[model samples]
Structures are given as C-alpha cells and as structure tokens.
Target: MAKNTGGNSLKLKKFLNRDNTVGYVFALPFIIGFLGFTIVPMIVSLYFSFTNYNMISAPQWVGLKNYVRMFTEDNRFVNSVGVTLKYVFISVPLKLIFALIVAFLLTRKSKAVSVYRSVYYIPSLIGGSVAVSLVWKQLFSTKGLINNILHSLGMARISWFGDEHAAVWPLILMAIWQFGSSMIIFAAGLTQIPASYYEAARIDGAGIVKQFFFITLPSLSPVILFNLVMQMITGFMSFTQTYVISNGTGDPNDATNFFALYIYNQAFKYFDMGYASAMAWILLILISLITFIIFKTSSTWVFYENE
Candidate 1:
C-alpha cells in the first residue's frame, strides 16, 4: 500500500510538470476571468431574461413574456431595432470604405506619412468618450460649429436634431469619423501584399484602377472581411454617442434609439431588468447570425495567399 501511494504521487508530479499543464497554468488567469465575468454573467442574464425581476423583488419566472412584450407590446422596441439596423448598415460600409481609402493613400514611404497616420488615429482613441460625444452633440446643435460653417458658405442652417431623418446622420457621421483602427489594419494588410504582384500587373498593361480592382482589392479581401465583421459588431453595439447626443431620450421621436441605448434605458431607467436581458440576448443572437452569414459568404470573395 505504501509503494502504490508513492507511485501515484510520482505520476501526479510528472503530469503536473508536462508542457500542456504549464500552458494551462499560464492560461489560468484568463480562464478564471472569462468564466467569472463572461460566462457566469451570460448564464445569469439568460435566466433573468425569462423572469420578472426588477432588482427589488425576487425574480419570478415568466417564460417568454418579456420577448413577447418586446415584439408586440413595445412600439419603442421595434423602432429601436429599426434605428440600430439603419445605423449599422449605413455607417459600417461607409466607414470601411473611407478607412480603406485613407489607408491606401497613406501607403507611401515617408516620415511625414507616419505622423499623418498618428494624427488620423487620434480621433478613434478619443472618439467614443463622453467628452467627444458631447462635443459632437454641440457641433450638430442649431448654432454649433457645423451650422456656422454652413452659414459662412452661404447655406441655410438646418435642424440636425429636431428632424428625425437628420438626427441619425450626426451619429452616423460620428461612427464614420472613428475609422482609425480599421485604417491601421488595412494599412498593415496593404504592406503585406507582394510588390512583385503590382509590378507584374503593371507589366501586363494594367492601369491604376485595374490594378487596384484586380490586385489590391483581392489581396486585401481577408483583412476587409475581418474589419467588416468587427466594425459591424461595433456599429450594432453603439450606445454612448446616441445616449449622449440624444440626452438619453432617443429623440426626436426615438430616431437615434439604438438597441444598446434602449437596453440601457430598460435596465436602469425603467428598471425592467428582465426586458433588458431579453433585448441583450436578441442583440447577441443577431450579431452572431450576421457574423456567421459573413463568414459563410466570405469563401466566395475572401482570398488567402496560402490557399
């Protein structure tokens, strides 16, 4: 019995000393954090989504009532969905395109180009902050800098916030303005493309436009896919700008009531924890479905050099 116990202890020590075990030890902090902050909260929120919990009373399981209310009983919920979709679709593509253009332009080798990249990237670093949002709100206000510029140009001042149609544009423009991260990614991808490919294209009588379409675009497709997915997720999850610009009211008439802001209002302002949870789950599922679709379709367009 003593020999057997000693053998087992030796085996356990050997196992613990293995490479895989060491890797796990290194990864333990991330694992604990993911479980504690992400997985556990997700499970709790899923449970809350099906219950009637106001953070005051004990949770009462209601089973799909919150979801039904979101679809059938809440006009604001439906409008918020529409507004969020509109924002995501409009801002994401334009932002990606603009980022690609800026990155392409900045691909030249020069000391000033690096400085330009840093200057352009500064907006993204501070773009999502409350202070930036407040400044953006003021810029679009009736007598703001933008209106002043238009007036100087002999154009009439427009009501940016009062008009529902115009209200979403400022937010969309803000979304597009913070394209620095995507631009940096695109610039990196551009550098990875072999110069020989462009040389061969030029030799083959390919014009600049043709070279861009046939070579640059196809070469950068994978990066574009990655940027698209990430930006779309960010666009859908946008809240701070809307919350600040609209004064947490989602006015004029919920025009900027992004799904995220709506969820915040439900969770904190209205104290509808259950409903907010349901909305959050819906958003998660929606983003997952869209990402899945993009990945599925990417096979047709996204190219890899290894393949």
Candidate 2:
C-alpha cells in the first residue's frame, strides 16, 4: 500500500510539473511584457507619486505634498473632478440605454438589422479618434453641419464650443454616438436569453411590455450590470474626444477638462509628475471602489442563470 501510494505521488508530481511547464510557456510573453513594461512602470510611478520628479531634475522625495496640494491648493483638480463626475453621471446611463435599445431593435428579424447595427457601431470605431473629434468639432461649429441644418430650418444658431454650458453637450452627444461596444454586449446578452421564457409569458396573456419588464429585463440583469460598470469606468476616463474637440486646452472655462485630461496637463503640460501620479492613483482607487460597490450591490439585482 505504501509503495502504491509513493508511485501515485510521483505520477502526480510529474503531471503537475508538466502542467506548470505548459502554463509557463503559454504565459511567457505576457509575463515578460508585464514585468518589463507594466509592472516596472507601476513600481516607478508608485515611487514617483511620493517625489517631485520634474523631467529636468532628479526626483526629490516630497512625502505627501503632492496629494496635499491637490486637495487644498489645486482648484483645477476640484473642478476637473466635478466635471468628470458630471460627465460620468450624464453619459453612462444615456450610452447604456441607447445601446440596449439599439441592441433590442437589432435582435428583431429584419432585413436591415445587420446594416443598422453596422451603422451604429461605425461611430464607436471613429468617435475616439482625433480625426473624428476634429470632424465633430467642425460639425458642431456655428456654421457647421448641425448648426447649418438648424439655421436652414429657421432656428437660431447655438454656440456649441463657445458657450460653457452648451460646449459640454457636444461631448455628451459624441459619447452617445459611440454606443457600439455596449450595443454588441447587449446583443450577445439578448441572444443568450431563452426564447421559451418569452413564449411562456406570451401564452400567459402577457403583452410585449409586460414580458419585457418581467422576462427580458430580469434575464438581462447581468449584462446590464456589466455595461453599467464598464460605461462608468470609460466615462470617468474619457480624454481624447475632449482633448481633440477642445483643442487640448480643455477650453471654454474648462468645461471639457476631464479628470484624465487634467492629469495629462499636470504630468506633461505643467511637469507636475508627482501630482499627476497621485491623481492617477486616486483615479485607480476611485474606479476600484466603484467597481467593488457595484459587485456588492449586484447580489440583489444580477441574476446568474447558472446558479
């Protein structure tokens, strides 16, 4: 019995060693790249967050000065935070809702379904690009396509980029136009939902609206949660559209000065590396905390079909 047990242990050890070897081989590129790029930079940035590391000079330890200054001295940081929060709160839900609606529409059997989906998704592909933002800037300009159409319709032209209040709307519109990713996710989720459930609800004399609220929404809760979390995170981290559309200044009284844009300004524009690193870490913490809260709250609403 002892000899058999020893033989079994040896076999298990060999199997485990082979598995480890295969895992390492599969993970080699990622491990090497992570250590070389991501891990090293993270470590360096962690250290830099505590030090004044202007590009011209060696880093000097500043303890918590950067963080303290950010909280107390920097009004811009506070304003950026407020702007980011507003953008996130406004854009995320609109994006998710629009995506869900489009996805639902796409799920219907129509000849033009794929074409509509493709058209909706095209904006998302282009919306984040500098070229697209430039085009959006042009389109929202006083004499541009949108205003020209409004003018052609006998309406007064609105200042899209000039007015602080109106300037943010263009960004919001741009975000809403890029609902493709979320739409795709919603489409996938819609497909996973069993048609039998809907059929049963219909047999029970449930209308489309009733079936949607009771059957569709409940079934799509997990996807809704996923899209919500992702949209929130993406909204918070938005930069390129604002940067390109606002001409990299976050102009018109800093209305478009998102948190990430503010961090870029701090790190690159102003050479406040330490403060920028602190802000990056703060944003990281904020995202992590928000995600954790979502996960915690998900237990009540997120219906896992497997369980």
Candidate 3:
C-alpha cells in the first residue's frame, strides 16, 4: 500500500508539471507582450508621477507637489474636471435614452429593419475619426451648415464656437449622434425579452405605454445599466469631438476643455510629463469611483431572471 501511494504521488507530480508546461507555453506570448508593453510603461509612469520630468533632463523627485498644485492652484484643472463631469452626466444619459428609443423602434417587425440598423450604426463606426470630427466642426461653425439652415429659415444664427454655453452643445450633440453602439446593445437586450410578456399585457387590456413601462423597461434594466456605464465611461474619456470641434483648444472660455485634452496639453504641449501622469492616475481613480458607485447601486434596479 505504501509503495502504491508513493507511485501515485510521483504520477501526480509529473501530471502537474506537464499541465504547467502546457499552460505556460500557451500563455507565453500574452505574458511577454504585457510585460514589454503594459507593465513596463505603467511602472515607469507611476514612477514619473512622483517626480518632475520635463522630457529634457533627469527626473527630479517632487513627491506630491504636482497633486497639491493640481487641487489648490490649478484653475484650469478644476474647470476641466467640472466640464468633464457635466459632459459625462449630460451626454451619457441623453445618448443612452436616445439609443433606447431607437432600439424600441427597431424592435418592431419590418423587412427594412436591417437596412435601418446598418444606416444608424454606420455613424458610430466612423464618428470618432478626425475626418468625421472635422465634418462636425464645419457643420456647427458660425457660418456652417446649421447656421446656414437657420438663416435660410429666417432664424437667428447661433455661434457654436464663440459662446461658452453653446460651444459644448455641438460636442454633446455630436456625441449623441454616435449612439449606434448603445442602440445595438439595447436592440440585443430588447430581442432577448420574451414576447409572451407583451402579449399577456395586451390580453389584460394594457396600453402601449403601460406595457412598455411594466414589461419592457423592467426586463431591460440590466442592459440599460450596462449601456449607461459604458456610455458614461466613453463620455468621460471623450476627446476627438471636442478637440476637433474646438480646434484642440476647448475654446470660448474653455467650456469644453476635457480632462484628457488637458492631460495631453500638460504632457506634450507644456512638457510636464510628471503632471500629466498624475492627472492620468487621478482620472483613472475618478472613473473607477464612478463605476463603483454605479455597480453598488445596480442591485437596486438591475434584474436577473436567474436570481
């Protein structure tokens, strides 16, 4: 019996060794790529965040001075924070709501539904590009398409890039137009809902609005939460639209000065790599906090059939 036990132990050790070898072999490429690309840069950035590095000389240790200045003396930082928060809170919900509405319409039976979906989804595919952003800028420029339409219709032309309040709207509107990603997610969620729920609601004399409120919304709450989180993250990280529309300056009193652009300016434009790294870390923490809050509150409304 002791001999048998010793043999089994040896066999188990060999099996584990063979399995470990196979696993490591399969994972080697990803591990090497991560170490070379992600981990090394992240470590260097973390180190840089604590030091003053202007990309011209050796890094000087600054401790938390950058963070301190960011909170206490940086008015642009504060304004960018406020602008980003406002942009996220406003654009995310509106975009998701619009996506949901469009998803509802698309859920209706129609042979043209496929074509409509493709058409609506195309904007999202190319919306984040420099060319599309330039197009949007042109559309919202003072003498551009929108104002041209207003002038043609005997209305006053609004200054999109000159007014602090109105400059951000063009960016927000452009963001909302790229609702195809959320809309597609919503459409998938809508499709997953059992049709019998709506049918039974109708049998009980429920109106369209009632059926939607009672059956559709509750069933799709999980998907709504998903889309909300995703869109909110995207809104907070948004750069191209505001950058292109405002000519990379977030002009007109800096109403559209997003945090990302601010970080870019600090790093490349101002040569404050350390400050940029600190801001990048801060943004990451802020996003993580918001996502945490969303997830913490999700249990209140997100429904799961398996639960």
Candidate 4:
C-alpha cells in the first residue's frame, strides 16, 4: 500500500511539472514584454502624478497640488473637458446612426453594393490622419473648395474656420464622415441575424419598419452597444484632427481644444509632465467610469440572444 501511494505521488509530480513547463513556455514572452513596456511605465506614471517632474529636472514630490491646481486654477482644463463631452455626445450618436443606416443600405442586394461599401469606408481610413485634417482645413477655409462652390452658385461665402462657432461644425462634419468603422461592425451584426426571422415577420404582414424595430434591432443590440462604447471613448480622446486643424493651439478661442490635446500641451509644451500624468489618470478614471455605467445599464436594454 505504501509503494502504491508513492508511485501515484510520483506520477502526479511529473504531470504537474510538465504542465508548469508548458505554461511558462507559452507565457514567457507576454510576461517579459508586459513587465518591460506596460507595467513599469504605469508604475512610473502613477508615481509621477504625485510629483513635479519637468523633463529637465529631478521629480519633486508635490502631493495633490497638481490635481488641486487642475480643478481650481485651470480654466483651460475645465473648458477642454466641456469641449470633449460635447464632441463625444454629438459625434458618437450621429456617427453610429449614420453607420447603421449605411450598413442597412449595404446589406441589400445590389450590383454596386461592394463599390458603395468601399467608398463609405474610405473616409474612415483617411479622416483621422493629419494629412486629411490639413486638407480639411484648406477646404473649409473662406476661399477654399466649399466656399468656392457656394460662390459659383452665386451664394455668399460663409466663414468656416474664422468663426469659433462655425469652426467646430467642420470638425463635427469630419467626424460624421468617418462612420465607416461603425458601419462595418453593424454590417457584420446584420449578417449574423437570421433571415428566417425577417421572413416570418414578412409572412405576418410586417412592414420594413416593423421588421427593423422588432427583428433587426433586438438581434443586433450587442454590436450596437459595442460600437456606442468605442465611439464614445474615441470621440472623447480625439486629438489629432483638432491638433492638426487648429495648428496645435486649439484655436480660434480654444473651441477645438479637446482633453487629450490639453494633456499633450501640458506635458510637452509647458513641461508639466507631472501635471499631465495627473490629467491622464483623471482621463483614465473618467473613461472607466463611463464605460462601467454603460455596461451596468446594458443588462436592461442589450439583448443577448444566446442567453
């Protein structure tokens, strides 16, 4: 009996050893890379958020001074937050709605469906680029393409970038034009919805609107939630288009000033690395909280067919 127990223990030890070796082999690269690149930087940044670390000088511990200053003293930070919220609220829903409409159109059987999808998606690929923003800046200039076209039609040229109120509309338009990513996601979700449901609805004398509201929407709720969350995050973090369009100043009157751009200016332009780190942490918290709220509320509205 003692020999039999000893043999079983030996076998168990060998099996455990083999499993450990294989697990380590598979995880080694990820562990090394994460520690080297992500974990270390995250730790460093957290420490820096409590200090005064300009690039040229050693960090001086400042406690919560940076955070307090941001909340109390920085009007720019407040304005940027407001601007970011506005952009996120306006752009995300519009983009998602437009994408859904386009995706629905694309799902129809048509000879030019592929071409239309390609054309719609092209804007998304190009829109976020600095080069594209530069082109947009020119095109929306008082003497640019849009104004020129209006002039050709004997209409007065309107100020697009000159006025602060009007300047933001161009950026909003640019964001709306890049609905392709959301459209692609919606298209995939639409494809996953069974055609049998639509056929049954049609047999029951349901119209197109009825089929969409009852059959299509409930089925695609998960993808809609996904796109909504992603678009909100992306719109909130938007910087490049604003930076390129405003030439990094967030002009005219800082109307294009976004939260990420504000952080960038704080860190690099003003050499307020510690303050910028604090702002980054704040942004991280904001995004996490918003995402959490969305997920928490999702159970009420987001339909999971498999469940």
Candidate 5:
C-alpha cells in the first residue's frame, strides 16, 4: 500500500509538470478575469433586464414587461434603432472606401509616406474624445466654419442641426473621419501581396485599374471583411459624438438619437435600469446577428492563401 501510494504521487507530479498544465497556470489570471468580470457582469445584466430596478431601489422581477414596453410603447426606441442602422450603413462603407483609397495611394515608394500616414492616423487617435466632438459640433454649427465656407462659395449657409434630416449628417461625417485604423490595416495587406503576382499581371498587359480589381482586391478581401465587421460593431455603439454634439437630448426631433445614446438616456437620464439593460441585450443580439450574417457570407468574398 505504501509503494502504490508513492507511485500515484509520482504520476501526479509528472502530470502537473506537463506543458499544458504550465500553460493553464500562466493563463489562470485571464481565465479568472473573464469569468469574474465579463461572464458575471453579463449574467447580472441578463437578470436585470427582466426586472424593474432603479439605482436606488431593490430590483423587482417584471418578467417580459421591459422588452414589451420597448417594442410596443416606446417610440424613441424605434427611432433610435432606425437612426443607428442608418448611421452604420452609411458611415461604415464610406469609411472603408476612403481608408482603402488612402492606403493604396500611400503604398508608393517614398520617404514622406510614413510621415503622411502618421499625420492621417492622428484623427482616429483623438476622434472619439469629448474635445474633438466639441470641435466637430462647432465646425458644423449653423454659423460655424462650414457655413462660412458655403457662403464664400456663393452657396446658402445651411442649418446643420436644426433640420431633422440634416442633423444626422454631421454625426455620419464624424464617423467617417476616423478611418485611419482601417487604412493602416489595408496598407499592411497591400504590402503582403507577392511581387510575382503583379509581375505576371503586368506581363499580361493588365493596367493599373485592372491589377487593382483582379489582383489587389481579391488578395485584400479577407482584410476588408475584418474591417467591415469591426467597423459595423463600432458604428452601432457610437454615442460620445452624438451626446456631446446634441447635448444628450438627441435634439432636432431625435434624428441623431443613436442606440447607445438612447440606452444611456434610459439608464441614467430616466433612471430606468431594467429597460436600459433590455436595450443593451437587444443591441448585443442585433450586433451578433449582423456579425453572423457577415461571417456566413464571407466565404464567397474573403480569399485565403491557405485555401
């Protein structure tokens, strides 16, 4: 019995010394964080979504009441969903196109290209900040610099935020202005294409445009898909610019009332924590559905070298 017990201890020690065991030990902190922070918060929020909880009072179970109110009773919820979809669809595509164009242009061999890339990327680094949003608000104000430019060009100075239709444009434009990260990704993709492919295309009389369409685009499709999904997620969650610009009122008849801003207003402004939690879950579901659709369709467009 003593020899058998010593043999079992030796086996256990070997198992613990294995690479997988060591790796798990190193990864224990991240696993703890993921469970404690992410999973726990998500579970709590899911519970709260079905309750009536203000910040001050104990949460009362309300079942599907919060979700029912969101769909049937809340006009603002409907408006916010519409506004957020519009912003995402318009701004994400434009940002991707602009980023690709700039990346393509910057690929030429030149010493100044690196400097230009850094300068262009600065907007993305600061674009989401309150100060930058404030600057953008002023730039698009009725009597601001944009109106002054229009006046100089013999065009009528337009009301940017007063009109419901026009109010969403400034927010969309601001979203498009932060295309630097996508541009950097595209630039990296462009560099990875083998020179031999371009050489063969050139030998076959393929012009620049043809090479771009046939060679460059196909090779970069995977990167494009990645940027598309990431940008879509970011666009749906946009809040700071709208909050700062519209003063959190979603003003001019709620034209710029993005989904995230509406969630904020519900949680903090109205003190409706349960409803806000429901909205957040809905946002998560919407984003997941979109991401799933993109990934499912990606096989048709996203090329991989390994395949």
Candidate 6:
C-alpha cells in the first residue's frame, strides 16, 4: 500500500508538471502582453509619480510635491474626490439593490426568461458608448425631451447641467440603468441556491419577506459582495459618461468631475503627466484599501455553504 501511494504521488506530480507546461505554452501571448503593457506601465507610472514630467520635457524629481499639492492645494482634486466618493457609495448600493430586485423578479422561471435577460442586458452593452452618453446629455438639457414633458405637465424649467446640485443626478440614473451585469450575476447566484431551502422555509410558516430576509439574502450574500466590489471599482474608474456628456469638461462647475476625468485633464489637457501618474497611484491605493476593508468585513456578512 505504501509503495502504491508513492507511485500515485509520482504520477500526480508528473501530470501537474505536464499540465503546467501546456498551460504556459497556451498563455504565452497573454504573458507577453501583461509584461509589456500592464506591468511595464505600472512600473513607469510608479517612477513618474515621484517626479514632475510634462510631455514636452524630461521628468524633474519633485519628491512628494505632487502628493502634497493634491492633498492641500488642489481644490479641484478635493471636489473630484468628494464627487467620486458620493458617486461610488450612493450609486454602488443603488445599482446593486436594483440588480438584486430585478434578479429576483427574473428568477421566476418562464419560457421568456432568456429573451428578457438579453433585452435587459442591452443597456449594459451600449450604456458606455459615446453616442448613448451624448443622447443622455441631450435628454436632460433645458429644452430636452424630459423637460419638454415636464413643461407639458405644467412643471417649471430647470437646468440640469447648469446646477451643481442636480448635475450628478443624471449620471447616477445612467449608472443604475446599466445594472444588467450585476443582475445577471445575481440571477446565476439565485439559481445555485437549493429550492429545498425555500420549500422548507415555507413549511415552517415563513412568508415572502421572511424567506427573503432569512434565506435568500444569506444565500446570496457572496454574490452581493462580488457585485459590490466590482461596481465600486467601476464607479471610481467611471469617466466616459461624464466625459461625453460634459464634452470632456465635467461641467456644472466640476460637479460631475470624477477622479479619472480629473486625472485625464491633468495629464493630457495640462500635460502634467507626472501629476497624473501620482493621481493614478493614489487611485490604485485607494481602491486597494477599500477592497481590503470590504474583504475583511465580508466574513461577518458574506455567507458560503461550504464554509
């Protein structure tokens, strides 16, 4: 028996080594791209973060000047940070909740479910396009379709892009409208949950609300955590809607200026590549910290059956 066990171990090691060789052969292109694009750019960005490099000139070592200015001197940086935080916290939760509700509704098995899922997912496929964002911007303009309908209803006219208070609302709406990705994930998670649990819960006198609260939520918490992290990251990285809608200005006095937009403006618009690199690193660090905190707290709320 001992000899057989040793032979099995040798065979397993040989199989694993062979598998790894085949995997590396298949992954060669990805490995090259990763090294040339992602890893190299990250290393260069880290170095540039410590310097002041305009596109036209060599980088000058500024030590921590860029970081200091970002924290203490740049009001636009502060505004962008605040705007990003609000967008992430508010939009992430709302998007996830909307996705969860839709997922639940869509889980009711029907012949039309596949078609309905594809139809709903259309928005996610097109939501980030410049044309769609342009249309959305026009939709909320002073004399646009929404306000026209409002006026026909005897409502007052309002400037969506001219007011700081209202400028970000349309963006949030756009974000929520594209909850299809999360909805699909939730739907998949819902299907994984055993029907026996629900049947048992019903037998114990639980109604819909109680079942959702006590069974469905706990079972779906892992999926929710995944969606939350992904959406939060996407929220922080969001730029296209703001860029296209505001014509790359993040208008309404910068009310819709997200972190990525600010970084873009700093890099390309002002040619402050070094400062932009610093901002990028800051964003990376911030994302890492937020993700870490979520993972740390996940053990308290995120449930897994095998665990």
Question: Which candidate ranks first by TM-score, i.e. highest?
Answer: 1
TM-score of 3: 0.91
lDDT, candidate 3, equals: 0.89
Ranking by TM-score: 1, 5, 6, 3, 2, 4
Runs with alpha carbons beyond 4 Å of true place in candidate 1: 1-13
Off by over 4 Å in 3: 1-18, 152-154
**Candidate 4, TM-score vs. the true structure?**
0.89
Task: Give the per-residue lDDT digits (tens) of candidate 6, residues 1-307.
Answer: 9999999999888886897877997899999999999999999999899999987779999999999999999999989989999988888899889888888878978879978988888889899899899999899999999889989999987798999998998899899999998999999999999999999999999998898889889999998999889999999999999998888888889999999999999999999999999999999999999999999999999999998
Q: Estimate each model's TM-score.
A: 0.94, 0.90, 0.91, 0.89, 0.93, 0.91
Expressed as tens digits, the lDDT of each residue in 192-257 for candidate 4 is 888999999999999988988898788989999999999888887898999998888888887888
Q: Cα RMSD to native, each candidate?
A: 2.2, 4.5, 4.0, 4.0, 2.5, 5.7
Model 1 lDDT tens row, 143-199: 999999999999999899999989999999998999998999999999999999999
lDDT of 2 at 72: 97
| Model 2 clash tally, residue pairs | 0
Colliding pairs, model 6? none
lDDT of 5 by residue, 1-307 (tens): 9999999999999989999998999999999999999999999999999999998999999999999999999999999999999999999999999999899889976779988998889999999999999999899888999999999999998899999999999889988989999999999999999999999999999998899889989999999999999999999999999999999999889999999999999999999999999999999999999999999999999899899
C-alpha lDDT score of every prediction, in listed order = 0.94, 0.89, 0.89, 0.89, 0.94, 0.92
Residue ranges of candidate 6 with Cα displaced over 4 Å = 1-20, 152-154
Question: What would you estimate as the lDDT of candidate 6?
Answer: 0.92
For all candidates, what are the clash counts?
0, 0, 0, 0, 0, 0
Query: What would you estimate as the lDDT of candidate 5?
Result: 0.94
Clashing pairs in 3: none
Q: Which run of 10 residues does model 4 get worst, by summed lDDT?
A: 160-169
Tens digits of per-residue lDDT for model 2, 1-307: 9999999999888876897887997899999999999999999898899999888899999999988988899888888888888888888889988898788768975668878888889998877888998899999998999999999999999998898888888898888888998998898899988889989998999997787789878899999998899889988899999988887888889888999999999899989898899899889988899899989999998888988
